[model samples]
Target: MTQLALCVMLVSEIGCNRDGLVICYVVIPPPDQQWGIKLPNDTWTGMMGQLDRQEVDMALGPFTMTPQRASVCDFSVPLHHENFAIITPRPKLQSDVLGFIKPFTVQVWLLILTSLLSVATAMGCVVWAEGKIFRHSEKNIVARAFLWVFCTVTQESSHWLPKKDGSRIIVSFWLLASLVFMSSYSGILTAMLTLPRVTVTIDSLADLVSQSALPWRLETGAAILTYLKESKEEVHQKAYRNMGPTIYALLRERQAVAEGKIAVICDETSMKKAMDLDFSTTGQCHLYIAQGKVMTNAMMSLAFRKNSKYLVQANHRVRILLESGLWHKWIGKQVANSSHCLRHPRLDRREGIQPLNLESFTGPVLILLTGATVSLLVFLCEHLSHLYVQPPKSTA
Candidate 1:
């Protein structure tokens, strides 16, 4: 199903074979082997063009199942199915510079701060309303309420609580909410710091596009380009627009992907071959296959001229290769001839958490340094203001 040599097996299965089977017809290849299927009436031609014009009985090699291709020629029952995948640079551990805030999003942090302020304001209002009915100190109740909220969020036991029903209710509900917020934050942050939390690797097309500079491209005239161009999805349309005119000859561009310059999208077979070639050439996996599939339920099959008498025999042969697992065996044998790069990396490798290290504390340490710098600036500004103050001579 994958290798050109395997096509011999398929050809044999259609009519003849070395297993004492006799041939009824001879096989022939169209002049252009690397032709892409053009829209039927678009006045374009390729491998599928040969089939369309009745120049070839069947076309071999991996091809994605699409409605357009189906209308032009009949595909045998899928020898195998493959989804589009991406090859990008292996993601290294991202810098933990913003590690502290990574656990919560900006909106989340803002909401948390808002919640604290809102609860404190509510409690302060309750205290003020109750001040007339009860006998308690009323000085700096706002500041005190703020302190209580802060301490509660930090899980610090507050030494005092307002002794009023309304204020107590506000505090009680906030306590429950804060418990959930703290537990989630703690669990996430702890997992981030104590366990190896791999940066959310590029797992999808959206993730790849999120990197402003990391545009994705495939070989010129690839079937995928047609898919991208005609796709109605916004991201797919955007990708097609942003892509450059890169051809397969631009091996350097693909190498750039290994260096994290850009990403390349390919059908499953091409991607597997590229990975295997990398493993064979360098003895290390330099490319990373994204965890997400670009397309699903894509069939890889041999194409036959419509209403060809051999169609039923080809379908039967394809089913045999698939059901018997011989197709996978041939694929594996071909893959081993080059190198064995696992289909994808181990999922646990990106759990992101590792043993606590100095790097893990980068976010907290940066916050502390920022606070200290601000405190120093405030101290300087205060003394400078004192020195510049005019004497009270005018009042005297």
Candidate 2:
């Protein structure tokens, strides 16, 4: 049995005899010496040491079965399987200041702008040709063309109308195109603005290594470190290299994660405990377990002294417990009884509906201001040009 209460309960339940006789000795190792690691002094410590000396009949905890450890002791059938994962702070809601523009990518926005300009220029040329052939006033054709295009984009009525059939046809096509463009923009923008944007910062180990903005660490003496160092995968190598040099204790790592100081790479079981602790205290689930699994089939089993007679019985009983779904039932009950901040994270209430600010309307507001400024400049330029052309007519 280990000092971790969950591990103690699990092991105690597994070791119970059919005669209702519970005859198992439990040893609590020093806090820093829970798992055995061979020291430079040619001596082992923790549960493995106690088992090696025949001081304890069995060692039970989240002890993973490694080739090195198996050499010294026999393992019972795995009580549970776990994966390596990263525990990160829950992503914050993205600022809405420039969120309105998130509906389309930069290339898309540029394409739309290019299309608008091309159509406006084509319409202006068509209008100019009609005026030239029919000898009608052709003044301000560019301005009128742009105004018509703007109105189409905004779905607003414009005073200017195309007289000729050819120009009308062009205008008709532009209106259809504008309708589609506007509809897509409106739909996408509404969804982006009204719905909260949740971001997963580190989805995979590769992502964890590539993103240098967040410092990441692992608890000292973690089993996953050995896996990372020996992994053939390039991503794992990179992640190992990028990990912070200073190893953190479990509580220190959890605190760092909660305070947004660092992200931690840990096993799923430990991650869940951290999450439970966080939720219980803060009344919010601030920690998120990354989706990526660094290593799978990491079997956790009870360790016994080499060729111990109890190994056979223990393996059989544990297998029975697993096959009968008792282990899963216990795990489910543990999770269900654990306090959670949200029943359904996606559907749960968020920091209520944030009041919409001017920043939230940045895209449309900037467009309106830009259009007004351009219109004012165009009006001033036209008035000045007229005055200059009229010369001294009033004086004469």
Candidate 3:
């Protein structure tokens, strides 16, 4: 699409009909040929080979400009500058009611519980000692202690009173601590419930390499793979080494990604094409383009055979098109024509404040129901025990 738009613009600018002066040539299954290595086969493949053999006038596509390829074939001025991107399935949004507790890890929650228990135990011991020494009226030491602790943590007033100076001092400190804890928890929990959190399954090349379960792979003959293998950086080298067996086609990689089997490292154009197709078929956009570009500074240009007569003209026209921003405009128009699912991902769609559903309150509702059932059972057991221990009054 980019090449076609540029060709049209070129013809208009040059004041010549498309048939006589300028012709658009396309190279499919991009030769995936890079400068450094020589394939084992005698016959060469891709645009480089065709250009070397003088079979085509010009090869159009996202043919990147590299030192090795530039040495052999003359390149037009860069048509587009693109950084390699990693495409992975969008992480699913968690809907479990207990998901509200996910902001804090299990260890953090355990620590909070331990602190609560310790504070309650300390308060109970202090209250019992004060009542024993001072003769204060005290009842249900353990239950009252825990109730006081719960009320303090919840920032609610408690009826229990501590008479001794030591007990009062402990309570005062506990209140201050509870205030801080409760305030922070409330603020964080509210933000979590209001704006749902979604985990990023894959953010960068390192992330993809570290999580080996997903088993990432590159398309066969992709220039990015060559770049990764040849890169001197340890991170890029490790990422390339971690890649699973090379998949020969982009369509296969797209299918694997849609099925949640694998992730593919590809250029933006290929990633967009796969995402568009995935959205069209499933009516949902499950793919996500990761945060940053892998190859920071990469430029793509048209490849012409060595010493081709059209090099100067093609270079001038491509430079003009790029300078005028026609390339970006054409890309925007293409993306605009895609489906809404692709343009606006489902996870990002927040039309308005959605009403809380039953699922949203599942954890709290279950806790309420369980507590009620247990309380009823305990009441029945206590009543039965009382009847057995004390004989009922005779009507005599």
Native-referenced Cα lDDT, model 3: 0.71
In candidate 1, what are the lDDT values of residues 253-359, reduced to their tens digit? 54777777778887666666666666777777667777788877677787888898778878877777889998888787655733434434433344444456687
Which of 2 and 3 is the better model by lDDT? Answer: 2
**Candidate scoring better on lDDT of 1 and 3:** 1
| Cα lDDT tens digits for candidate 2, 254-329 | 7778778788887676677677667767777777777777888788887888988777777777888789988767
| TM-score leaderboard ranking | 2, 3, 1
Ten contiguous residues with the weakest lDDT in model 2: 337-346
Q: Clash number for model 2?
A: 0
What's model 2's lDDT at 288?
A: 72
lDDT of 2 at 201: 69
Assess the local accuracy of residue 85 in candidate 3 as a C-alpha lDDT between 0 and 100.
Answer: 79
TM-scores of all predicted structures = 0.68, 0.81, 0.71
Which segments of model 2 are wrong by more than 4 Å? Answer: 1-4, 13-31, 37-46, 49-56, 105-107, 245-253, 337-348, 351-354, 362-396
The collision pairs in model 3 are none
lDDT of each: 0.74, 0.74, 0.71
Top TM-score: which candidate number?
2
Q: What's the lDDT of the predicted structure labeled candidate 2? A: 0.74
